[model samples]
Target chain A: MDIFLTLFINGLSEGALIFLVSSGLAIILGLMGVVNFAHGALFVWGGYAYVWIYQMTNSFILGILAAMLIVFILGIIFEKFFVSRLYGNAPAQILITLGLNIVFIEIIRLIWGNTPIAIKKPDFISGTTIINGVTISHYRILLIIIGISVLIIVNYILKNSKTGMVIRAGVQRSDMVQALGINIRLYFTIVFAAGAALAGLGGALYAPLAGNVISTAGANNQILAFIAIVIGGLGNFSGTAKASFLLGLMNAFVAWFIPSFAVVTNVLVMAIVLAFKPEGLFSEGRKSILRLAVKK
Target chain B: MKSLREHIQRDFSKNVIIALSVLLIALLIFPKFSSYTMLNLLTRIFVISVFAMSYDILRGYMGFINLGHAVYFGGGAYVAGILYNKLGTTIPVFILSIAVVVLYSVICALVMGKLSFKKGTSVFAAAMLTLALAEVVRNIAESWRDVTNGTDGLIFKVPSILSNRIFFYYFSLIFLIVMFIILRKFILSPTGRVIIAIRENEQRAEFLGFRIENYKLIAILVSGVSAGLAGLVFGTFNRFANTELLSITYSTNALLYTLIGGTGTLYGGIVGSIVVNVFQNMLLNLRSIHPIFERWLIFLGILYIAVILFMPKGIVGTLRHFIENRKVKSDNEKSSKTEKAPGE
Candidate 1:
């Protein structure tokens, strides 16, 4: 039971981190209809930024903030300069974003060198704590808290805020929104950057949890986030979050039991889900957001 | 003599005939004067061009974006490598590898087509699924350390004659010509027409009583077989096989090659492979000039973006567009000799 509890939290924490990345991805896909393949690069940037800041100041909060800020700016630049120009063009988006992904990842290697950078959980949240019969790592619990708070905060904002309404409207009809005198382009940039920032924050938090950050982690984690987004339904925010957790739990158990299956399980789930439910398990059976996203 | 000359002029362009003969003659004798590196680069280009052409069958001809195409290409290489390692490295083993690759490619294509062509699967999902399926194969290869050697990559011998550089270059050239002809024949066949029809309009093709999925499967089958064959030859040429051959980079390289040369045009793949491989070779040569040249991928990625943005139709496609446009304009002028010409 104690082992189960530990594993459960471990899974949840893993899911939380995945959610951080995919939620941003889902939002970007929803509003702009562009699947940011460069998302993984952004996540890597966040980790490197966090590591750089943490090493300089020894402040975890500052590191996370700096990571988010830098990634947000990058997000804006990507949207304004690259992604925006190719709006409504799906294939170009994939190619350009992938190109950006490669370039940025190479840039990371250039700066950080090829070695993995090590980091530790901060002193306050470094140790494990016991609650009744359940013992949990403090850092993981913090991650869970951060994940949930971000989820709630974003949910609240999306539901009640003007920006949220505009975003949802833009997804349905960006031209319509533009006709109404809303600068849809600005929204696209802001949302893309915001999504990037979330991925950055995920990276910042992920470094301590994983013990180190490596350049290759971006691609590996990007695949996981892709699986999550696919299973959750592309452009469906809530579905993506659910899929991430399910994947995290599955990964945790698979790794714990049959370590060899760990690599295959994520893809296997994606295949099965794709085959059985092409619209995704949680999707509302609306048109494929992808079809709607592309230019005629 | 005038009749014969008129017949030749009527059937084919004199420029095309002259160009083809000149290019073929040059290819035949150029290896004698070329550096060893240049000779080998051409050989690699030949094998990889076939892979790109195979990819064109799907992406250009069928409008399917398969992110896991490396599965067949890399699978062929691995099968060739593994078979050569386990069995003896001989001409017979090479023949046996061809048989194995054909079977493997067919089965994988069927499964790949099935997984990605579900009832409600979108193009995006299909693409992602292909990537997932590839990752699964790669994962299996990585873990199955006993057979695959666990990503350290399998090094093995090839048939004796294939090891010779000049022999292999000519051999790959012949291989390229054969595959190009075969692929062209396939594209011109009735089944290939239906596949093109599906690409142009899936619904209309379905309504016309063609089983869209079956046609798609057929396309994938042909593509996989050819791509696998390319890999088989590539592995033999390299005397090595690695999981990297099964990676997204390799798959994307096929996309890049096809895109650069212009998709759908068989000759474009040949041109693309030559252009890309030569460009890559040049970049590698520049490594002595600057340490940054070692990171040529950044430049490659930038080139990729630039191609997608500015030359979306690719070199051949754009050139064809221009030539075709000019021909149309000239034809219109001939038709309306007195009327004002249409605006560009």
Candidate 2:
């Protein structure tokens, strides 16, 4: 029972961390219909920025915020210049973003010297507690808190805010939104940057959990996020959240029993999903062409 | 009677034929006069150029991007290494490996095509799926230590006939020219034109009662078989097989080659491969002169971006576009002059 509880918490925390990364991807893909291949690069930058600032200032909050800020700026640049130019051209977008991915990843290696940088959890949350015969780590609890809050906050925004309304509309028809006199391009930049910042936040939190920041981590997590997006349905937010949790729980149980299966789980799940339901398990299956391309 | 320049200008095909035959003749005699390094380098280019050409069938012709393209190439090399190691490096074993490679490439293509080419699958989904599949294969290869040698890479001996560098160099050159002609023919075939039509307007192709998916699957199969063959030749040339062949770097290298040379143009891949490989070789040579030269990937990435942004049609595509535009301009001038002559 104690093991079960531990695993559950562990899994939820894992799912929450994944959520932080994939949520941005889900939003960006939803709003802009832009598949940002350099998202992994943005993620790595976030992690390195977090590590750099954390080491210098020793303030975890500051590091996380700084990471988000740096990545946000990078996101704006990518959307405005490179990705914006290649709108509606999926192949070119993929190639250009992939090129940017390679360049940015190499730049990370250049700055950080190609070695993994060690990191530690903040002093406050780096502790353990015993409750009702259950041993729970404070950090996991903190992760759960952060994860739920982000979900609730984002959900609230999507449900209640004008920005959410625009994003939702943009997903279906950005042109219609533009015809309605909303600055859809500004919204594109905002959503892309916000998604990038979320990825940055995920990276900052991820470093202490993994115990180090490495350039390759971005690629690895990017794959994980891709899996989530695939299973959850393209550009579906709530679906992404559900899929992320499902993956996390599945991974935790698999790791406990069939460790080898853990490595193969993502691929297996993805392949099965693709074979059976190419639209994804949680897809709305809209016949909207605009979401497929934000054409000029 | 026209001067030599005017005659050549009027008859483009004859001039191209003359230029190509002369180049081919020179290359046939190249090994004897060239140094060993030059011979080896050209041999490598010939083998890899086939791989690039195969990649162009998908990227250039069909407008599909398979990020796991290196899997077939890497799979071919591994098959060669493993079979040679297990069953003795005989001519029969080499033949057997070729057969195995074709079957393997076909099976992989079927699986990849079925998943990525499904109805409602977006461009993003296909790209991500292929990448995930490639990574899965790489992981499996890594963990299967007994066979793949656990990423330290599988090195084995080949038949002595293949080991003869001059013989192998000639072999690869023939392989390149033969494959190029075959692919060019394939592109011009009825089925190939249907595939190109699908690329131009998938909806129109579908509405025209063509099974676009089947055509795409065929494209994948042809590309796969060619890539696998190239990989086998590359392994024979180097006498080595590594998992790095399966890496995204190689897949992207294929992409870079096709993009630089011209995606749809069959020979563009050859040009791109030659240009990229030569540049890579030059950079390696420059490493002793500067520490910065060691990090060549930065430059590779920059080149990728620059080519896509500035040279979107690639070297061959851009050149062809320029030539076609000039021809149109000159023809317009000649037509106007003829009109004026009638008036006079």
- TM-score of every candidate's chain A: 0.95, 0.93
lDDT tens readout by residue for model 2, B20-46: 899999999998899889999999999
Candidate 1 lDDT tens digits, A100-166 = 9888888888778889988988888899989977988999989889988888888777768899888
Model 1 interface Cα RMSD in Å: 1.2
iRMS, model 2 (angstroms)? 1.1
Lowest-sum lDDT 10-residue window in model 2 chain B: B1-10
> Which residue pairs of candidate 1 clash?
none
The candidates' DockQ values read 0.72, 0.72
Q: Tell me the spans in candidate 1 whose CA falls farther than 4 Å from its real position.
A: A131-134, A284-296, B1-12, B333-344
> Against the unseen true structure, what C-alpha lDDT does each candidate score?
0.87, 0.87
| Per-model TM values vs. the true structure | 0.94, 0.94
Q: lDDT of model 2 at residue B290?
A: 87
lDDT of 2 at B151: 83
Alpha-carbon error at A185 in model 1, in Å? Answer: 0.8
